[model samples]
Target chain A: MIFKIAWRNIGRNKRRTLLTAASIFFAVFFSCVMTSINRGVFDKMIDDSVTSNVGYIQIHKKGFWDDQVINNAMVYDQQWKQELAAIDKVQTVIPRLQSAAMISFGKITKNVLVTGIDPAAENKLTNISNRVVDGEYLNADDQAVLIGEGLAKKLKATIGDTLILLSQGYRGVNAAQVYPIKGIVSFGVPALSSGMVYMPLAAAQYFYGANNLTTAVVLDVAGKEDVEEVLPPLYAKLDTNNTYEVMAWQEMIPDILNLKQTKDSSNKVVTIILYFIVGFGIFGTILMMTRERQYEFGVLLSIGMKRGQLAASVWIETLLLGLLGAVVGIALAYGLAYYLMVNPIVMQGEMAEAYTKFGMDPVMPASVALDIFWEQALTVLTITTLIALYPAFVIFRLQPVTAMRS
Target chain B: MNIVTVQQAQKTYNPDKIPVHALQGVDLTIEQGEFTALVGPSGSGKTTLLNAIGGLDLLTAGKIIINNQDIATFSDSELIEFRKQNIGFVFQAYNLIPVFTAKENVEFVMLLQGKSEQERDTRVRELLTAVGLADQIDRRPSELSGGQQQRVAVARALASKPQFILADEPTANLDSKSTADLLDIMLELNQKENITFLFSTHDQRVIDRARRVVTLEDGKIISDERVS
Candidate 1:
């Protein structure tokens, strides 16, 4: 019967109840959609960085990444390849020997990271061939280099141009190699296009006069979360005086992690402020509800209705109102998120440049998450329950005698 | 057996200075199945004494025993339980929750006691019909006339089936015609159900119709008489 009474009580001032619910609905809806967009942007950035720039997990030679010396290269024996393949969750691992070298075309010269890789193994790890815009990709045993579009334009070089490369190899030995540019590719980042270069792993190894690999190995994992799981065991198996450090994408790119962390922290600050604002809106309605029924409460007390029962009825009704708003908000936000994901919003001009600069996709695609809905529901419930405290306390302390006089 | 007992009860207001004594150690006993009235002017403290007896207010000193339980010593929770079972009240203002219909207002008392819906609906209908509000059962408090609202209040008070019913100036805000109609219906129910009706009022009409009247003056009972 109290339930019926509460239901009817809520219906008494339909407009007020709806207003309170509207505030809660907007709060939940806005937060869900905004957070989805933010998370989507960050996820895209991570994927781009992991696939194109750095693999999710990288296997480097002991002390090579820290010291950057060619002598620190892990031995390129067949044993390392077979052992790495046997590791669980190992998607693909490409052996590489990277060095800072000067590439010169006629009068033009610029320093670049000359990455030495097996074209086949690199292709299996990443879609390197699809990025070729001007010239053909590497053939087996093809001693060629794929330079970026920006690098080609700067050097006044085109397909089939032979470029001169000079570098100091291990043990302070002077080394140089002449390579024909087989491709001028479209590297995503503007900086990378101007300063990046790739060549076959063995030809560069022969140029450096090293019988084996120099310094670095890159690895691609099955999933982002699997990075930690794969790294620890790989580290344990290859543990040698803690000389080698297995770095995940997150550690390799600290700036990107900082970017995501800063964005989420600001998002939380805005959400908390909105909660308090919506809380006051709901609280206002409840204040009117209790005040309007002051005389009624006294009468109820006089009639031997327990004050606690009255409080419970009011609390249950408010809870229903809050729950309704939360559910509706989540449902509406989900529909919006689905639509945005299908037809992603295209950002133009500075925003597009900003996204590319931060290594993010220019399009905003909303990610669907069940945890988001549950979180909004829980937040709404807690705020609504807290707002009911004042009314319940007032009801509990009411005196029937004074109320009747009033 | 006594249905309500007040033993040397005192109710005082304004604790700091110039305290106005409301109920000055008044002793009273109301027997089972009796219709009684505490009649007085505005400042006679009749309402104060009624409140002290009804467990709505605490006595400055002394005790009140209702239905064999010493309510003056009862805790807040115990008092609520005792009141839920033993007492029903109708206020001077038509104190029906504005949101609920006449039927819902009457059904609320039984709701607190956790009565089933069917039992509550049947009892509510019977009570409404008894108060001559049968046709207006579905109307909200604002939709009803002043007289009809009072009738709903009466039905609500009787819905819980309490041992004693306290009506503090139930017709104070009603027109004379509404007052006459309300008193007539209450008198009929009192006779038919053999339920005790205790009223604290200044209204001559309620005092005139009551079977027994206890007059109070300046915080003390000046006269206790069987008027009818």
Candidate 2:
């Protein structure tokens, strides 16, 4: 009987009920969209930095990350490669010999960070072959180099152009080489686009006079979120001594992680404000309903309805109303997020330039992760539950004689 | 037997500020199965006396005893339970729940009493038939006429078979014909079931039909008359 009364009571003022539900609906919708876009932007940032440049996890010789000199390079061991590959969740292990050198093309000379890679393994980690914009991709034995598009533009170098590279090799030996440009590649991050050069691992080791040496081994995991999971097994399989330093992307790039944390904190504040507004909207409706029905509550009380039962009935009504709004809101948010995920909103003009300057992609997409929908829905319902207590307090304190007179 | 006894009932409004006595040591007794009317002008304590006897308001002093139990000694929840089992009420505006159909309104009290479905259904049908609203059982109060709504209120009041029914200005919102029909139904129920009734009213028609009339003037009972 309480349930029946509660169900019917919701329809007593249809317009008021709809207005309350609509407020909740819009709150959930906007919060879901806002959080989804925020997360999607961060996901893009991580992809640009982690997937394209630094792998989700990296293995370097101790003290090499702090000092990138060629002398700190580790010995290239086939046994280490087999051990890393055997770990669960480790998708690919890419070996690289990296160093800084001065490149001269015609009269233009600029400093560039050169990385030597096994072409096939590098392609598996970063899909670098897909990023080739000009000329052909490099072979594992090619006596050639791939230059970033911005660097090529600055040097006025094109495919088949011979570029002069000079740097100190292992043990401070003079290292100089002339190699034809194999391809031109573009990166979303402006710094990487303007300062990177790639060559075959063997050719780079030969040029640097550091045969059988690699500066870093980048591990591509199944997902960036799985990086921590992959770490334990890799640590257990490799040398227990501190010879190899395992670094997750967050540890490798603390600045970007700090930026993401700040963004998330701000997003949380905005979401709380939205829920606060939603609570007021629902409370307003409840106040009106309780005030208007004061006399009816009196009659119910006088006719032997207990205060707890009456309160429970009203709470059930509010629960139903909140659930109705939240379900519809989640469905609509899911549809919108799914659409945005498939066809991301591309930034243009100044916005695109600003994003590129910050070393990020210019497009914004919504995350369709299932947690966003349920988390927002649960939050709105909790607010509704709290607001529903108002009517219960009124009913418990009601005097039937005065109420009926009113 | 005395079913209701009001002994030195005193109700003073705003005692801390300027005290306006609504019931000043008024006393009365009601026999079982009697149709009684408490009649007075505005602010003469007729409704105050009725409220005091119905346990709807606490008196400033004195005791109201029903079936040999002082209602003043009962707690708030106990009073509510006492009223549910012992007394019924009909308001001037016909306070039927707007969301419920006539049948559900009639069955509400019995539901509170935890009556079985079979018992509640039989009693609801019987009460609605008694009030001449058997055909309008499924209609909501909004769909019913003023007379029909009042009839539903009466049926709801009697649904639990209380010892007495207290009605405050039951005919104030009704037309003459509706009032006459309502009075006729109440008279029939009183005669057929021997159910006690007490009403506070300014309506002459309601006063004329009562077997006993108690008139108050200035918070004190002036006359108690017994008519045919």
Candidate 3:
């Protein structure tokens, strides 16, 4: 009966209840959307950073990551690739022979990071085929190369044009090769586009004076959550006596990891301000709820309702309102987030340029993860419950006769 | 037997600044099954004495004994429990829960007492019938007239089977016809159920109908008279 009264009392002044509930609704809705957007952006950054250049996990010869030279390349065959691919959670293994070389096309010589890869394996790992803007992608036997669009513009070269590559191979052996540009492609990161080239693994290995050797074998995993679970097993399966290093994308890019952390801390400050504003709104409504009904409370108390029972009824009223608002907010937010996830907002203007300069995609998406809804809704509900203490206190301290006269 | 005993009852509001002594060293006893009226002008301490007897307010320097227990010895919470079990209250405004139907208002105290649903329903119907509101069982307070609402209040007060009912100006807001109807129901319950009723009011109709009248002026008892 007390609960019934409380439930009806919430609707006694429809406008007041709606005004109070609207604050809670916006608090949950905006909080969920903001957190989802933040997570989506960071998740995208990690995905682009991993798949665009660095695969999820990279395996290297000891000291190879510190100093990249043809001599430090690991000598492995097709059998090793088969073995690594058979491991659990390893999507595919990509072998690369990486070096820095000077390329010249009609006196426009430039230093670039040269990567030699098996086109099929590279396609499975990075989707290099989808990035091609002009001409065909590399075949396993082609003595052709894929050059960045920015690098192509710099060299004044087009597809099918031959470029001279010069570098010192393994053991300081002088290496020189002339290769036709197979395709031109763009990169989200401008730095990669400015000076990067790709060629067939066998051709680059033969030119560099290294046979059956590669600098790194990269492994692709599902997502950020899978990285830690997948790494320990891969390390355990490797030859313990041999010198090898396994690094996740996070370890390889400390600057990006630091950027995410900075963004998270700043997001916390904004969330705190929002919570502070919402707390006062809830407190004011509850204060009015108790203050305006002092006479009613006294009448109830004088007629034999216990203070504790009255207090509990009032608390339940606020709790019901909070839960209602949170559920509605979550429902509305879920719809918006699902839509945003499917159709991400493409950034434009200077923001797009800034994202490119920082080696990140310029799109903003919202995550529709279930945890986001639960977390945001519970936070608002807790705030509403906490603010209900004011009414409980007022009931506890009520002087029945005095309040009745008031 | 006297169900309530008041000795040297006194009540002071705000002792530190501008103290208004509402009750001053008075003595009164209310017997079971008696219909009594405490009549006085505003600030004459009739309501204060009633509040002290009902355990709604504490006396500055006195003892109110209900059922042989000195109510001053009880804590605030204990006093609330005591009122629930031993005293019922009816306010001038007919303070029925706005959301509850007439039947629910009558059943509320029994629910507080943790009575079984069957017991509460049975008692609610009986009390509302006695107050001539049986047909208006499902009507909320807003649906009922002032007289009907006051009659519901009476039924609610009697629902808990309290030792006595304290009505503070219960008919003050009612018209002459409604006030007469309310007094008739209350008088019938007093005579038929042998229940006690103590009311504080300035209404001459209530005073005329009461079996005992206690009048006060300036926080002191000016006269005590009995009729019929």
Candidate 1 backbone collisions, by pair: A73-A215
Lowest lDDT sum, 10 consecutive residues, model 2 chain A, at: A233-242
What TM-score is obtained for chain B in each of the predicted models?
A: 0.97, 0.99, 0.98
Better of 2 and 3 by TM-score: 3
Among all candidates shown, the one with the greatest TM-score: 1
TM-score of chain A of 1: 0.91
Global CA lDDT computed for model 1: 0.82
Per residue, candidate 3 scores C-alpha lDDT tens digits across A252-356 of: 878778988998888778877887897898788788888889999998888778988998898888887777778888999899988999998899999988987
Off by over 4 Å in 1: A1-7, A76-79, A171-174, A211-214, A317-328, A357-359, A403-406
Locate the minimum summed-lDDT window of 10 residues in model 1 chain A. Answer: A207-216
Model 3 regions lying over 4 Å from their true place: A62-83, A141-143, A171-173, A209-213, A235-242, A264-267, A323-325, A347-362, B222-226
Q: Between candidates 1 and 2, name the one with more favorable DockQ.
A: 2
DockQ per model, Cα:
0.62, 0.66, 0.74
Cα-lDDT of candidate 3 = 0.88
TM-score of each: 0.91, 0.89, 0.90
CA lDDT of each prediction against the hidden true structure: 0.82, 0.90, 0.88
Error of 2 at B123 (Å): 3.0
**lDDT for each residue of candidate 1 in A1-406, tens digit (9 for 90 to 100):** 6777777777777888788778888999999999888877777777777787678777776676677767776666678887876788887777888877899999999988887887887887667888899898776477889998889999999998999999887666777989999987787688888988888887778777665765667777777888777876787777646656677788787888899999999999999999889988888888887887787788777676787788888888888778767788999999998898788899999999987765466899887767777888889888878987888999887776666566
Measured with C-alpha atoms, the lDDT of residue A229 in candidate 2 is 88
